[model samples]
Target: MSPSLEKILSEIEQLTPEEQLTVMGHLVERVKKHITQVQPKRKWSDLKSMAPYPLLGEDAQEWVSRTRKFADEHREGLQREE
Candidate 1:
């Protein structure tokens, strides 16, 4: 609808299908990179605001370590049931 978008579409129309696909892939990657750069890096503290239940004193590292230990202890017995 916009003049800039119309102009871009007209330019793309002149390209071969392969060329159009290449250009589309490049544009998609550029948009993805831009989005990744714009988003703020999340911190462990940010989880408190987003979580439905309180995290209290337990942080991500502690939870992961405990889970890994439990999984290691149970993995052999759990696999036998499969």
Candidate 2:
């Protein structure tokens, strides 16, 4: 987990039992708020839209560099094949 999330959890643990419950309630509310704030704004990948090029700019450069490093086994070179 992130350091900030860990810190929040630590603070909740240090609170009295009643305060811990309140903290948990607040955390749940904040998480729900975050879900609402983020869910609709998220942009999932579109393979069809991404079909023309899977890489661009720095990503493209990285892809090319990694591809060159693969040598013979380019397709599965970077992956853990079954």
Candidate 3:
């Protein structure tokens, strides 16, 4: 850690628990403000056309049907064993 941060931490340790919490709250708000100012807000629409249709090489409905059929067959096999 940097010497400045270490010095600040030593000072914080001398404060009461409530004072420490107050300091923490201020720090958190400052960081949140910094992040909002520096980062761009993202939108779901931004992902449009990023992936090709049949994203995983198959239609989504077809994949769901195939997966359900598989799970049903697996469960039937387990039932037979039971």
Assess the local accuracy of residue 13 in candidate 2 as a C-alpha lDDT between 0 and 100. Answer: 84
User: Global CA lDDT of candidate 2, please?
Assistant: 0.74
The candidate scoring highest on lDDT is 3
Cα lDDT for residue 64, candidate 3: 95
Report model 1's TM-score to 2 decimal places.
Answer: 0.43
Candidate 2: list runs displaced more than 4 Å.
Answer: 31-82
Cα displacement (Å) at residue 47, model 3: 1.4
Q: Which ten residues in a row have the lowest lDDT in candidate 3?
A: 33-42
Error of 1 at 82 (Å): 22
Q: By TM-score, is 1 or 3 better?
A: 3
Query: Roughly what TM-score does model 3 have, to 2 decimal places?
Result: 0.49
By TM-score, the better pick of 2 and 3 is 3
The estimated TM-scores of all candidates read: 0.43, 0.33, 0.49
lDDT of 3 at 34: 75
Number of clashes in every candidate structure?
0, 0, 0
